[model samples]
Target chain A: MSTDTVETIRTTVPVGAQYAPGSLLDWSEALVPGDIVLDERVAPNAPWSAVVRAGDVLTIVDVGGNQSADCLMFNAHDTSERYSVPDTLTWQGNAYVREGTVLRSGLGRPLMTVVGNEIDRQDTIGGACSKESNTLRYGHHTAYQHGCRENFLAEASRHGLTSRDLVSNLNWFMNVPVEADGALGIVDGLSAPGRRVAIRADMDVLVIVSNCPQMNNPCNEFNPTPLRMIVTRNEDTVR
Target chain B: MVGARDTASVLAARADARAQGSNVSDWMPYLPAASSPFAPEGVDPSALVWAETVAPGGYTHKVVARGTRLRLEDVTGDACAHVLVFNALEPWERLNVADTQKIPWQAYLGAGHPLLSGEGRVLATVVADTSAHHDAFCGTSSDEWNVVKYGDAAPQGPSPSGRALLTLAGVKHGLTPRDLPPSVSFFQGVRVEDDGALAWQGSAGPGTYVDLVAEMPLIVLVANVPHPLDPRTDYVVGPLRVHAWRGDPSGPADEHYSASPERERAYLNTTDYLEARGL
Candidate 1:
């Protein structure tokens, strides 16, 4: 096949950001002047939430690599509508989230769309770790350890939400593969330092993230690391 | 009857009250009723292997052989049955709700849909469904959620949550809370609107049922509690009726087994595994 034919085959499905012709940094650096809006670094095992306005692109950077970013999204106008893993996976006809995947809500509406993704696959079914589950899986000693569930509770509380508001979340950069025997295994990640995935908000969305603090699994490679969050808008679409 | 007596005398009387016979009847299949009101066509009452009635906010777990048909009934209009399934041979191979939904490319589960595992095997098939209102998303309520809403959520309390009940049931089978994955809820429904809002659909009234035929040897856990999205203020729920009978696994001739390419492949995978083991 010709080079163009190969490129066509690769582009038929939305390729991961890493497979793009240019690096994420190269693409971001080419943006118009003054389009950058917010830039922040989240500490390991921390919780963060922000409102990424419609039309803005939120880029998540794996600063130290192999760290899982557990995330939940909600409509800024209506908390009743939030990300739905089943809807997202069913509509896409694929199990993993990748570029061009529309992050759908429980109502089957798009909340956000993946504009870029460095990781080849992202986990939507490997639920966030909880204190109770950690204790049950690892040991009672892990009961005292903070988990993604705690982080979500703390951050969601700031937005007037509670435990009932929590749902299965997306784990970016984490590797949880389903084996041939129907078992899910959380193995080492496929991400590396400086890898990035960018998603554009289809509507005003309240994005809650937990820099995973899991120490009992390879999800974080046993050591948590910091992450970078950058929001940028297209210059011509600036409002 | 023994008259009112001292504690020692009463204890001696109780010890002597034991039935003097072999306990073989306990293991024998006896027909409690002539027939099941909800049994599908051609299913004989004598084929029933087990029957149970789980009270509101109660739970139960059982291990059934492959092809066993389990019928779950909402005995009242307010019952919600949250169900989980695992491969009995390998507990780690449990139901994957995401694959169950995504593999069939259908988010709303109903009759003719196969419940899939993460490794792409069918654990069971929804052979029949009378209550079309089922939920494959928004798993059962948690203790924290129940406490926030009802002020109490102990497993044996007045208002028990499904998560707590399932956890307790899991312990009975040597499984733990970690073994339980996201479960499917029957009798309570949820629909997403055009603008992304979730609307709750309550039960389809008493007598509604769903039948699941196991495609593999399975450990099934069920907790009958109020759905988390249920809008009721008072913690009111009804009883669930469970009935199981021996049946044959879905073959290529079965409609559900050949419902879709995805389901067909899953059934094939299950057959391959079972055949290799001489099951």
Candidate 2:
């Protein structure tokens, strides 16, 4: 047996609430013409990940505005081939992401392209919060509070992920601006309720997300709320 | 199965090359440095494979072949060069320091230690170390950590993050976040107190450096930033200098390669891989 299997058995987390496909999310926020591959509501302060096939559209609905989702992507066939933020910024020449911007992989290829967006922009810098950071930023009392890192740990465990799997993530709906002197400011959010951002996968991409559960920062306004992930195939796909 | 097949085919190719009266790795393409921004004063560029200077809070990723020595220097004191190593051919098989420490019962990694991969392959060996210690536990600084420590005036973006830089570098190498493994923070020291609490300690001064020799073709991801446990009042920032050179030759009798039986096996795996590839 492989060493990875033994390690997985030692660290496997008990499964939590399970929801059927397309059962939790309402289709009102984003329109989907073809068959829905996956749809599930991600509770506030929780993490969820799924495989988004090439040609499929994954719509993330901020059902409650001002919520930031920490997201990461990996090539399904090769987990090592994953997303690159610096390359994305270099390829786009823009600090923030928007419609028409292609999310570049580590190998300088397009993993997904943002085809639709309802918000002004999403932060590529305001990283996801973790327990250690919560204690460092908020206070010692917040150390016990679960952050996106904990959520990712719980969710990624299903796919045999561990500490090595965690990466720098994208903070959707959060407002972080580069200052005049190259300083960064993580402050209030630009998204409100009902904001939806959609992307079309250019390859088989595995996406993991953490619904921001932060209570100390202004990203989520200290009140974490639930959201939905809707994955749909294109009209040309033979689903 | 794929790794085994590739290894076999590579070995066969090496044998074929030997039969042809030429070495397969004689054709390794190494872009020698014409101009390197990181070379120290009076150092000629001809001897260097590549050299690059990284700004404060910057990150970079590059691949180094076996027998390549990576030299990292802090231009100023109080900086950290967080490093992550990954298998260039098979990204899934990467350095696991936890295994490196657990198997050998070592607490700190320096000269004589082998960085092991998940599949028990030797990826690199520490050729030289100037610092008294380097931490394997502390990761990197983040947005909120900066906010709390430096207040709202803290520098933004993923500045001093080991994980973030590694992730960015991994993707650039056709890899992803899950490929980021625990890293080594050069020039940063941690001491476990009597109660088992880790206390920050002093590392090397400016102009000091540590060098590692790659045992396998591997990805080198570095974050030029401050240690997360650094209690400095000012947001610690410093320029970093990186120099790559041709490392000493590899063999079974190498000091690091012969450290232990397990390490010997891992080194053999690397040799099997390199020999088969004709490199």
Pick out the ten consecutive residues of candidate 2 chain B with the lowest summed lDDT.
Answer: B22-31
In Å, residue B5's CA in model 1 sits off its true spot by 8.8
Candidates' TM-scores?
0.59, 0.48
Q: What tens-digit string does per-residue lDDT give for candidate 1 at A1-239?
A: 11112233433432221222221221122122337788887767889999989888888888667789999999999986788775575455455788889998755578889888888787776767766455434555565777888899999999998664676689988976654223355779999767788888899999999999888777776667777888889865444
lDDT of 2 by residue, A171-226 (tens): 77887664432234467888776788888899998999999877776777665666
**CAPRI grade, predicted model 1:** incorrect
For residues B111-187, write the lDDT of model 1, one tens digit per residue. 88888765457899999999988887667777656787799989889898787888888888888654666688898
Best by DockQ: 1
- Model 1 residue A38 CA deviation (Å) reads 17
Docking quality tier of model 2: incorrect
Q: Highest lDDT: which candidate?
A: 1
TM-scores of chain A in all candidate models: 0.85, 0.85
